[model samples]
Target: MTASHGNEIMVVSGASTGIGAATARELAARGFHVLAGVRRERDGDAIRGDGVEPVILDLTRPEHVRALADRIASDPRHRPLRALVNNAAISVNAPAEVLPLDEWRRLFDVNLFGHIAITQALLPFLHRSHGRIVNISSVGGKIAMATYGAYAGAKFALEAVSDSLRRELAPHGVQVVVVEPGAVRSEMAGRGAATANDLAAMMNPEQRRRYGGLIEAVVAHSLAFTRNGLPSARAGAVIADAATVRRPRTRYTVGRDAALLTRLARFLPDRVLDRIAAANLRPYLPRQGT
Candidate 1:
């Protein structure tokens, strides 16, 4: 279905890369006036295009979210935002047993709380336009992995919040939908692998001996899956569809592995799943230090 907006404006957070960047492109191609909200000016400049407007939007800053809301609320040309895509997120891989509290907070700050803040600030403008909210969650939200403790926790929280918001906004003619993707190809995946490698390197001798192997395995497995995963652009199209469909679904599960992973997660017992995950991730453990 075609997007409901005819020259309507869309604000997309985390548009610098991955699904956000691709979504921005897709929306612009579809005739929506797109605002590509990014944290860095360089990232923004790299993304500016024929129909895309790049804006500095760091989700962690309350003022940024508020200012953006105000802009949409007051702009005579585009007072009401037609859609808001809460796609900004950070992925940190570490076992919960060793994961730092600050790491968890940092993950939630951008992934869960930040999105909530931006959404709340923009609700008035969205309400005026009868707009939609598209949340870019992950397969981790629905399924627990071996080493993505904090990232998965944030995504899981986002899923819960999105569900509540969807129910609350339905009466106002607003739609909220969740997009869960599995192993999409993106630079973020590579960064996550690299981060894991660094973390493993930083561990003390005992710590490294106790958990380093498992951590490295997680990183390696992630790199392998990402190398073989669906393209980020494919996932972006699903997100764009979520934003514009007349009767958008409550959730859209994309990528070849999404269905399989979600089904396995749902049916397999927790202990059984854990065993499977351990086995799958074990092979990637860093080989003995060179």
Candidate 2:
């Protein structure tokens, strides 16, 4: 264990890659001691260096979450945890009707429930330090679209939870902030595409016939969105700001698309938004006969 310098410590989950990894590096660069939570030994090794301590954590597993809390609590060299970044999440893309209940539950397990569990376990440390909790949500949290039902639903719930948590923890001086990012370069899009493909492959002929083209379109759009999206580092910077700012906003919207779309969602009618979304998917829609 590294000796404590009395610098505030921050816990960033899903630090193995993407925004989480970027945030770990950014925070460490800013002179904060970062406990980067990864799921695998290899990932821990990958993130080792530059004031970043890699901790193996699997959010889906309660034991791992508990162990993390216990380890932090018992470590003599650590300062009280000053920030918690709930960045770990999984994405599943499918039409609402065909999407399995199990997959939806699994998404929530990692993105919502696991996050809540970690927050609860570490509240004592956060309270003691008068710290911050940064929840990584999405533009999907504010706007729901077809084929993204599962991911959007989870994000939506996360936003709600963050709101409640922020109000509840304010009296204790523990700030809860939501970072809503639009499409950004990250492993999530690739992983989501892979999962969608796997699910498509498992579909029966009838199922494929009914939904295959739409799924393919959604997956393709997702891939393109990530490819052209803002860098993860930008989002990481925003998250780091949310953690360290003297007076942070209730929510930080990252990326131009995220800001624009979220704003449009607030003023635009659903019927108009629906038409725009449908038009975007029109090119990929299956032919009338085929």
Superposition-based RMSD of candidate 2 using all C-alpha atoms, in angstroms: 2.8
lDDT string for model 2 (88-114, tens) is: 998999877777899999998998999
Q: lDDT winner among the candidates? A: 2
User: Per-residue lDDT tens digits of candidate 1, residues 1-290?
Assistant: 36545468888999999889999999888888888899899998899997788888989998888778777766677535789999988778987767778878988999999999999888877888799999999999988787787888899899999999999999998889999989888888887777777777777788877887788678778889888988878988899999888898898998868878888888988998889887887677666766
How far is 202's C-alpha from truth in model 1 (Å)? 2.6
Model 1 spans with C-alpha error above 4 angstroms: 1-6, 286-290
Per-candidate TM equals 0.94, 0.95
Checking candidate 2 for backbone clashes, the offending pairs are none
Off by over 4 Å in 2: 1-6, 286-290
